[model samples]
Every structure is written in C-alpha cells, then in structure tokens.
Target: MANLQESNHQENWENLSQKTNDSLIRVRKVLTLSRIILIVFLVLLVFLFLPWRQTIPGRGTVTALRPQDRPQTVQNQIGGRIERWYVSEGQEVKKGDTILLISEISQPYFDPELPQRLQEQLQAKQSSEAAARQKMRATEAQMSALDRGLNYQLISAENKVKQSINYVKSDSADLEAVRQFYKISQQRLERYEQGYKDGLFSLTDIETRRLNVQNDNAKLIAQENKLNTSRQSLLNAQIELDNIRVKYQESVAKAQSDMGTAISGQATAQGDIAKLRNEIANIDFRLGLYVVRAPQDGYVIKTLKAGIGENIKEGESVATLQPKEPLVAAEIYVDAMDVPLIGDRSEVRLQFEGWPSVQFSGWPSVAVGTFAGRVFSIDRVSSPNGSYRVLVKQMVPVPAADEPWPVQLRQGSGVYGRVILNSVPIWYEIWRQLNGFPPSLEREPKGDGEKAK
Candidate 1:
C-alpha cells in the first residue's frame, strides 16, 4: 500500500510539472503577439498625426479677366456691297479711321439728270432773284426822280399863283383910273351942252365930247372885266398847285408799292434757292455714309467678311476687335465632388500646358513651372460639361528666373490648376473614404509654424 501511494504522488508531481511547462509556453506566445500588436498600433498612431495637404485638381483655359470685353464684333451700319477693305485681320487701328468702303447698289441706276436739273432750277431761281432786285432798284430810282419833278412842278405852280395875283392887282388899278376919266369926260360934255344951250359953244363940239365920254365908259368896263378874269386866273393857279401836290403824293405811294412787290418776289426766290441748296447738301451727306470708320482704338482679332464685292446687311458683324490692356483669368471646371472643398479667395497653383515642369500641388514648395493664383468665384450651378466652373486670377506673376515658368501667358491657353483645401493626415483620409463620407476638417488647421512640426 505504501509503495502504491508513493507511485500516485510521483505521478501527480510529473503531471503538475507538465502543466506548468505548457502554461509557460502559452504565456510566452501571448506576450510575443501582444508586443507585435502594440508596435503596429504605435506606428499607425504616428501616421495619423503626420501632416498632409488636401487638394482638388481641375482643368481650365487661360482667358481675359473680363472675357466679355474682348472679342468685340464690328458690325456694318448700312446695307451695301463692300467696295474695298482698308484694313486686314490682326491690324491695329485708331478711332475714326476708315476701315472699309461700301458702294450702294442703286447708285448707278438712278437718274443722272436729277442733280443737273436741281442745279439748273437753283440757278434759274438765283437769276430771277437778281433780275427782281435790279427791277426793284430801277423802280426806286424812278420814284426818286418823280419825287424831284413833283417838287419842282409844285414850286412852279406856286410861283404862277403869285404872278396871277400881281396881274390882278395891276388890272384893278387900271380899272379905277379909267372910271375916274370917264366920269370927268361925262361932266365936261354935260357942261358944254349947257353952254351951247346958253350960246357959249357950237353943236359939233358938244357931239365930240359926248363921243369921248362914251369911249371912256367902254374902257372902264373893259378894265373891270379884265380885273375879274385875272382874279379867276389866280384862283385857278392856286387850285392847280394843290392838285399837283396830291398827284405827286399818290404817284410816290404807287411807286413804293411796286418796289415792295419786287423786293418780296426777290426774297421768295432767294428762299427757294436756299432750300434747294440745303437739299443738295443733305444728298451729299447721305452719300458719305458709304465709308465705314472705326469707333474706337483696338486690334482687329478677326474679320468675319473681308472679301470685296460681298453684300452685307445693315448691322451685320464684319469683324472683331480686341481692346488693349486685357486682363487675365483662369476659367476652370472642377469636379462636382470637389466643388464644396473650394471657396472664394482660396489659394490655387497653375501649370501651363507648354511649360516643362512637374507640380505637386499638395506640397507646393516642391512644385516647379507653376504660377500662383487665387480662386475668385465659385459657380452655383453645374456647367454644361457636368462640372462646376471656378474663376481664378493670377497673383503678381513670378519672374521666370524665380520660377521656371513663363512670365507672360497667352490668352486661351490650356491650363491645369489645383485648389488647396484643408490640411489633414493620410490616415484620416483613408478613414473618411472607407466610411463613404465627404472630406472635412476635424479641427481648424494650424498656421505654417505648427504645420512644419
């Protein structure tokens, strides 16, 4: 019995030793696995804090900053056949310079005698006016002469009246003398008759005295009649002078009226001539419209229709002119997925098509052959190409020596740009992508000083 118990205890001790060795091996394996997993977790944690830049890439074309101002279209102002082109494509021009000449199609078909007839009519009117003026002058001169003659006639008539008055006075004086003589002769005859009766004189002497008295009486009567006729003549002369003055005034008034009519006719003719001349001037102005002139100073970017003899309608586009001092801009189309990542005034890096350098936009310091720019606008709607439009303007262009890029970039050149977004770690990017969530910032990114760490 003692030998059996001792055997069982020895067996229990061997089993316990085996169990201990198995437990030690299992613990060793667990420690080795734990150390490996801890190392891997530490490495992943380190990667999560590493700084990385997020960028959205887009394609664009370089264009003028105000694209609407460029590519101006020149249109024809009138409909006609182009006679000649004074300027060619890509030519620079100044304001008011003649650019082309157009010819009216209906010019040759119009009546050639129209202008000549107008001119002839104008000349005829002018001549008629001249003749009317001459007639007016002649009439005025005749009026002046008539006025002078009338004045002289009036003076002469007045003098004739004075002479007639003097003649009447002289006749009255003679009549009085004759009457006194007849009275004396008659008295002497009567006394002789009385003496004869008293035997102092003969019959023949008395008869002679009577005859003398009768003759004296006849002379007195004749003198009285003559005096009356002279007075009547004076009255007639005064009436004739008054009539002459009235006639002179009437004649002068008639002459003045005729001269006024002539002057009026001359004025009408002159007005007609002026109107015809104005019409001719208007025709000349209309003819001047065949020449086309530049409205502003610019360069002709292209000619839509420059061939001679081509007919163009009014207001049709003839050419395009690009104004000087055009501004530059980048018209980019960003992917819809990346549109939310950009905003106004966001930093951008551009790479021109012909430039030979690689650009790592996430790490801009490692980039070459790229120009710096900023986002100026973000479209609220998608473009026709199923992408959002973003407008970018270049900062002060760096010199080619400073950055291996062109100092002057042409308009309409192809370009590629990257819109710099928030800075994050590569692990976060992987996590967000795996979760199917849009990119976002965990916290506000630090400045350059913190990012360098």
Candidate 2:
C-alpha cells in the first residue's frame, strides 16, 4: 500500500511541473508590455522637469497709450446756430483750421457788429467819466477859493469891530469931560447971581456964565449920543463878522456837496465804462468762436450736428476727431485672480486682430506673428466682469509687413495678449494645476523705473 501511494504522488508532481512551465512560456508578451509602459512613464516624468514660463492670457482692444492721443470730440464754449460747414467728415485738418462757421443765436450776441457797438459805448462812458473828474476838481478848487475869501472877510470884519470899540471908548471920555465943565459953569453962575442980588456983580457976567452952562450941557448931550452910536456900531460889526462866517461856511458846505455829487457821477460813469469794456471783450472772443476750428492736428471722423441753421447748445459736441500718429497700445482685461501675478514692465506678447499668429504661452521664443510689449499700467479696481484692465505698450518694434504698430494698428481693433511671469519646473506647474493652487513667483518683481529702458 505505501509503494502504490508514492507512485501516485510522483505522477501528480510531474503534472504540476508541466503546467507551471506552460504558464511561464505563455506570459512573456504581457511582461514585455509592462516593461514598455514603465519606460514611457519615466520619459514623461523627465519632460515634466523642464522649465516652463508661466503666462496670463487676456483679450482686449487696441488703443492709444496716452489719453490725449485717443479719439476726442470738439465743441464750442458758447451756443450758436450753424451757418456753414467748411469741411466734411474724413477731412484732414491742421490745428486752428476752420471746420465750421456758426452764427450767434443767443440774444446777447445777436448783433453782427456787437463788439464795435460796445466799444463805442465804452468810449462815450470814458469821456463822461473824464468830464466828471474835471468837474470834481473844479468843485474842489471853488471850495478852496471860498475858504480864502471867507478868511479875508473875517479878518476885515474883526478890524472894523476893533475900530468901533476904540471909538466907543473915546466918545465915553469926551462925555465925562463935558459934564465936568457944565458943573463948574453952573457953580460959577450961581455965585454970580448971589453977588448980583447983593449988588456986588454985573448982569452981563451972569448972562455969560449961563450961556457957557447951556453950551456945556449941549456938548454933553452930543457926546452921549456919539457914545451910544459908537456902541451900536460895535454891535453891528460883530453881527456882520458872525454873518460872514456863517455865509462862507454854508458856501463851503455847498461846494463840498457838489464835489461829492461829481465824484459819485464819476464812479458811476467809470463802472459803466468797465462794464462796456468787458462786454466788448466778450463779443470779440465770441466772434472767434463763430468759426469753429480744430484744436489739434487730426482727422474729422464724424459730425455730431448736421445741416445749416442747426442750433447748438454751449459745450455741445460738434464733431469727433482722431488724432494723427497715436502711440499704439493694447488695452487688456485679465482675471482678478491672475492680476496679482502681473507687475509693471512685465513682458507681454500680443496678437493683433486681422493679423495671423501662433502662440505658445510656455515657450514664447517659438511664437510667430506676435509682437513684444510691456505692461504700462494696471487698474487698481476690478471691472464689472470681475477682471482688471492692463494697458500694454509696445516696447520693441512691431515687425508688421508694412509698418510698425503705431502707424499700422488702428484704434478699437481686437487684440490677444499674454503677460509673462516666473519660470518654474513643468512638473511643479502641472502639479499645482492638478491640485488647484495659485501660481508662484520665483523672484521679486522689478521697480517701476528699473527696467524702463
């Protein structure tokens, strides 16, 4: 029984060996295919380790770099009615060249000779103002003469008053002397009469004494009257002096009042003259505005107002202008998330509209029909689309077939652009993209003026 069992086990082992050999032989193709796949994976990994230049793509319109170089509208400061059109649309105009001739429709400047009329008014008022000044001066002179005349009269009146006072004093002394003489004569007469009564004096001597007394009394009375007349004269002299002063003061006051009136008239005339001058100047300026001229050298693109007799309001748009020789640039908008990676003076490659181009963002050196540019400015705030605007100017010449961008590129044309950033390993970039991570900066950005050249 042991010998039989050993024989079966040996047969089973032989069968198992045969099956194992066959399985090994048949799986060779599968093992070869696995080895080929591993080699291919390793090659792909090596390629991923290469450097890749990161870029942010954007789309925008071609525009001028400077605001003044962009398209603009021409208008007048004052309102008017169009009388004639000097140039039509698409006409090339030099600065100060007349494009339209307008007439003043506003009532204030309706007169064709408005400036001349205002000038005449100004001259008339100026002449009036001059006459008033002359009158004012004459009034002042009159006032001075009145003062001198009044002073002279006051001096003369004072002298007369002094003379009257002296006369009054002399007359008083004479009256007193006359009274003394009369008293003495009366005493002598009384003594004579007593003597005559006693038959000791003659009648003729008494009569003579009486006559002397009468004459003395008459003289005294006359002297008293003279004294009263002198006192009255003194009073009259003083009154005359006071009246002269009052009269002269009134004259001076009247003269001063006349001068004031003349000055007021002169001021009014001067104000009117100034107003007329200003109006004349305004009319002159408005006359120039009647001929609407080009503000700068440009081409008239479109007329905002049409036809003769069309009324235009102040500061209304007259026509559109496109300045000659604009500094061409690309106005691009990029995602807000990608704006932080872009810095001033960053390198940009642009493909303008209507221009055939091939681009490789990671390999800019291999690009075709694209021009090199630099970031000139970036908007601080995001746009309505949650993107930021970036202004890109050509730093290098655009090798277009005919001319450069400044000459050949038209404003408002579409453009596609790529802003270049840091260079990183392709493997890392792929990983970041796969994991949804933001791009990294390999180095610090340049200063605003550092790479200006």
Candidate 3:
C-alpha cells in the first residue's frame, strides 16, 4: 500500500490521516492521482519541444489543371430553335461532334438559299466594279490621247507664231525702205517744180518727178498695209495658240471628270461587294452555328435548352460538357492569415470526396488513402468567401506509399487539403495556435527563400 502511495507527499496527506495503519491504507487516491498527473504533464512538456511539421488545412474542390479542361457550357453563336438532339446526357463525344441541331429563329436567316443569293449579289457587284474599272481605263486612255494631240497642236501653233513674227519683221523693214524712197522722190519733185518755176529745167522733167513721187507714195501705202497684215497675222496666230490650249484643257477636263465618275462608281460597287462578302461570311458562320458541336472531347453533362423547337438566344448555353481525361487538381482555400505561410513548392495532402482516407493534418507522412500534390497556382485576390484560393497539382513520380488517384475521381467533387510547411518545435506551434498566429517558418522553404533573396 505504501509502494502505491510512495510518490505522494507523506507529511501532507499521510499526516492528515489517522495514525491507524488501517485508515492510512484506505486513504483517498487524491495525492496519488495528483502525482501521476504531474508526471504526465512533465512528459508532455518535454514532448512539446520535439520537432513537428507545420500545416494549414483548407476545404476545396477537385477540378482540372487547365481551364479548358474544366467543365464548360456549350452555347450557340446565333439565336435558334432546337430542331434535334444528336447527343444525350451522359453520352461521350469527341471534339467537333454534333450535339444538337437548331433552326433559324430570327428573320434574317430564314431563307435556305440566303448565302447563295448573297453570293449572286456579290458576283453582280463584282461585275459592276469590273465594268467601272474598264470605263476608268478607257477614260485614262482618252486623256492620254488628248494630251498627245495637244502636244502636237501646240508645237504647230508655236511654229506658226514664230513664222508670223518673222514675216512682221520683214514687212516692217520693207515699209521703212519704201518710206525712204518716198522721201527722196518728194524732195526730187519739189526741187524740179521749183526749177521749172525758176526756168532752171523744162516742165517735162518736173512732170516726170511728180509722177515718180506719186508712185513712191502708192508703194509706201502698199508696204504699210502689208506690215499691218503681218501684225494681224501674228495676233491671229497667238489667238489660235491660246485657243488650242483652252480646247485641250476642255478635253482633258472632260476626260478627268469622266474618270472621276467611273472611279466613284467603282468605289461604290466595291463597297457593296465588301458588304455582300461580309454577309456571306457571317451567314456561313451562322450556318455552322445551326449545328451545335462539342468544343472538346467530353461527356454531355446536361441539356441546358431542352426539348425540340425550344427557342434559344444568341450566345445561350445549350448544354454542359465535362471534358474527358483532364489533368485533375485539388483547389483549396485558406485564410488570408495562413496564405502568407504557403510556398509555391509546398507539399499537399488531399482527401478526395467519396474516397476513404485516414489523415493526420499535422503529420502527413503516415496518412493513408490520401494522394500527394504540390502547389501549382494561388490567387492573388481573396475568394468570395474571403479565403485565398490555392491550386495543388498532382505530384509526379508519386511516392511509393501513395496509391494512384482513382480514375473515377470527378470534377467538382469535395476535397480536404493540408498544405505542409516548414517544421518547428511543437511548443512553438502550440504557442502560435494559442495566440492565433500563422504557421511558423523556422527556415523559409527552398523556393521561397530563393525568391526572397
């Protein structure tokens, strides 16, 4: 009995008992239990000094690694009525596989031969544009011909002007000579008449001199008329030269105006052709939209616009598709306080929904049925729930202890994730937890430390 109570304080509890051995032996177990508790506490305090891995736990969803690999909506690019369904929910389809058929719901795409008609319109406009171009070429040729003719006529007119100037100069010289002769004749006649009056010469000589003067006067008058004619000819030649230029300008201007008109017509036709071609292309694209096809290899999840003849608006979802064979990931959300402690290469332990797992959040090495992963992405901003999102990708060359993820692991399934961080003393972890502090990083993670440096 004493052996059982040996660890207890003998003076305190034993003295309180009677000196009777029977009462002492049958004493309460209060001091024994207190001693046991104290010993256990001491052992616990020593254990708290041991090293422990820090971790942050979060809830998340199972999803694809890439956004394109994720489940997505199948939509129609144009408004239409569901005519037929080529696929049903849960059916597998390949990329470009037709899922449903839709008929035109709007008035614009009603005509079955609409694209052909547009093509015909485009063809006609193209023909008109061609004709306009040909007319423009004809006008240009006409302008060139007019220019050539103007060059020839201008050269001829210039030569005529030079000839007229030369003729005027010759006529002026002849007129001056005639005036000198008339002057000499007049002086001779005056001298003869005076001698005849003074009886120095016979009346016959005076009469002959007077006749010579009249003759010289007549010649002078003719020469003056000739000079005037030459000047008039020069003036007429200049006027003709100007007329040629004006006439050529008129012809060239008419040609230029015609060419401009043809160009305007060609431009208008080309614009119309472009409009028709654009319409054709758009209609072709819209025609393709009538057959709703799967954008990727996937399974049809659900029909968004159900039933035949149901009207759907442009860009409306027709069905949902879950892509096949996606690279799956665990996406978890952690509190803002804990996000800073996460590292890009942080190890992740995932508990996928519908899968059995025995997890120790603080110690992931002994965990069972939980797959391993590493940080792949993390959102800079908080989620709607005020938690930061972190994406964890599957670990490559997986640990021999970890089993492969189940093939049946589907997207949007629930996941519980634990992001393993740096190791620290258990006491520090306890103190941190007690103080609501973030996980400790006794040493920064390899990747994070390098980044910090």
Candidate 4:
C-alpha cells in the first residue's frame, strides 16, 4: 500500500510540473507583448509631440517674472531723529496721511529759538503797527487843525482889511461934509459982516457970528488930514491880507498832500511786512531734507542696516518699503540671437517646474495660471556680454495673502516667466521682405488694389 501511494504521488508531481511549466511560458509571452506595446506607445508619443518635429518655429525662450510698474514706496522727504511715529508698521493710510513726526530742530534756515523769536517778532510788529496807526491819526488831526487855523487866519486878515476900508470911507465922507460946512459958514459970515457994517451997531450979534466962523474952519482942516491917514491904513491892511491868504492856501494844500503820502507809505510798509511773514512761514515748512510716509497700507520694512540713533547722510536709502501687492519678478538674460524674436505685444507661454503640468498663457489665464502680458520695454543697450534685456508686464492678479501690501513686497520671491515674441508665420522671412518698404515696396496710385514688393 505504501509503494502504490508513492507511485501515485510521483505521477501527480509530474502533472503538476507540466502545468507549472506551461503557466510560466504563457506568462513570459504576455510579458514580452506588454513590453513591445509599451515601446510602440512611447515611440508614437515622441514622434507626435517632440520639439524636434518642427511643427512651429520658435527660439529658445527666456523666462522671467512680471515686475510692478510703480515703485514700492516713495522715500521720506525729511531727515531727522524720528520724534514720533503716527502709524504702526502695517497701517492703512490715505492720500494725505501723516506717517511720522519729526522734532522741530535747527535747520539750515532755522534758529534754535525760532518759534519763540517769531512769536516775539510778530507781537512787536503788531505793537509797532498799532503805534504807527495812532501816530498817523495824530498827525492827520494836527494837519486838519493847521488847515483850519490857516483858513481862519486868512478870514481874519480879510475882515481887518474890510474894517480898515470902512474907516477910510467914513473919514472921506466926514471930510467932504466938513469942507461944505466951512464954505457955507464963511459965505454967511461975510454976508452978516456986510449987513452989520451997513446997519446999526449990534455988538453981541456980531461977536456970536465971528465965533461960529472960526469953529467951522478948524473942523474942516481936521477932517481932511484924518481921511489921508485912514486911506494909508486901508492900503497897508489890504496888502497884508493878500500876502497872508496866499501863504495860508499854499500851506493847507501842502499839509493835505503830505498826509496822503504818509498814509500810502504806511500801507506799503504793512504790505512788505506781510510778505516777509509769509516767506518766513514757507521757509519753515521747507526746512527738512526728507519726508517719510506710509507705503500702500503696509508695514514698514525694517530690514535695513540702520538704527534710530545712527546719523544718515543726505540721499542715503534708509529702509525699503513692502507694498501690499507682492509680486515675484525674475530678471533673465536673453541672447542677442533671440532678442528680435521677443518684442512688444507678444504672447508668452509659461511652465512651472514645481507644478509640472500647470501652464500660463495669454491675457486671460486658464487653470490657476497667470496670463501673458505685453513687453513694458526693452533695454536699449544689451548686457556687457552682449545679452539683451527686456522688461515685460505680466497679467496676473496678485496672490491672496493675509499680510497687507507693505508687508507683501518683500525681497527675493521665486518666480519663472516666459516672454512671448510673436506667432510668426511659416514664411516669416518672405513675408517681411514682401511687406518691407522703400526699395522693396511702394504704394500704387489710385485705382490700384494691392501691390507686392
């Protein structure tokens, strides 16, 4: 029974070995077929998509990141020991936001005690102006009084002349009356003397007549002399009045003119003082060398090798500012051979090595990729090694960040970019030659449609 069992076991083992061998052979064949299929597939993919196929003509492209158009921030205008900071590092600021305060120290045009001195000077000027105004008023009052006095003096002189003339006229009239009375009395006395001599002897009546004739002769002589003296007095008074009136009118006119001149001089002085005050104020504002402000609602970048107590020279860059919108711009050098291919308004295709399959192209980006943008400009001169440099603007929204703009524009972010030259036609050289001008092509006269070079 043991021998029979051994025989059955050997046969079973033989059958099992055959089945195992057949299975191994089939597996080998399947593995060889699979290898062939994989090779064929790989070869097909290479032929269809390899760059060497020359489906499109392109130069080796240089990659770079887009740069910001505006600078990170404007430097401070004033240089001094920062007295006080009005804002924190990352603070949102408006157009006219005050970023910091500098202590009012002595500047080029500043005195140590300028503020106090200015105040004192202003007060003194105020007092001086007031005093000057008061003096002007007093002078005007005096001038007015003088003018009035001169007029009165002239009037008095005229009145005196008039009185003198009236006296002269009365004297003349009295003289005339006295002469007439004397003549009439003499005629009557003569007649009476003749009648007395021819008639009877009346001694008392003759005596009375003689006394009247003597009195009339004396009165006439006195009246004539008084009239001559009164006429001389009237002439002297009229001459004095004429001279006094001329001098008074001249003095009054001069006084009035002088008052006006004084008032004009005071006004000019006031205007000059005001202009000087304004200039001083302007100088005060321009006293500092630098002005610092918040940069785009962001934190101050304090990475500079400077300290608060350090003395900074003029035009020295103290600190860099970080803007809210951070971008990573890579500057790459392109060869001269490739420069002409890349120009303004070209489309660039970008590939991220980190995200192998991800790409960026065109104005509107697709699939979490940045868009292509026009070239901002190209350096007129090439690099020292004859490599050309071109600056391009990238159409990409800034990546979202919790930090603000000032903090985001930090130095050294890694980015890659490609500059798009153009989608050149297959017959680019021929097309350029045909469309070129001057010796190559010219516009046809009227009635002609299209012309070629």
Model 2 regions more than 4 Å off: 1-32, 108-110, 160-239, 396-406, 442-453
lDDT of 2 by residue, 1-453 (tens): 999999999999999999998889779767888889999998888889887878899999999999988999999888888899998899999999998898878886667777778888888998999999999999988988998898899999999999999999999898889889989988998999999999988999888888998999899889999999999999999999999989988998899899998999999998998888887777777778888889899899999999989899989999999998878789999998898889887988888988888999888867887888889999999999899999998775543432345357889999999998777889888888899776786673466236422
Estimate TM-scores for all models. Answer: 0.48, 0.74, 0.86, 0.45
lDDT of each model, Cα atoms only? 0.82, 0.87, 0.89, 0.56
Which scores better on lDDT, 1 or 2?
Answer: 2
Candidate 2 matches the true fold with a TM-score of 0.74
Count of backbone collisions in candidate 3: 0
Better of 1 and 4 by TM-score: 1
> Sorted on TM-score, highest at the top, how do the candidates line up?
3, 2, 1, 4
Cα lDDT of model 1 by residue, 193-214, tens digit: 9999999999999999989999
Model 1: lDDT equals: 0.82
Task: Name the lDDT of candidate 2.
Answer: 0.87
lDDT by residue for model 4 over 153-232, one digit each (tens)? 77888888898889998998898899899888888777777888988536666777788878988998888788888888
Worst 10 residues of 1 by lDDT: 398-407
Error of 4 at 176 (Å): 12
Residue 320 alpha-carbon offset, candidate 4, angstroms = 3.0
Off by over 4 Å in 4: 1-69, 72-117, 159-235, 242-296, 299-305, 308-317, 326-370, 375-453
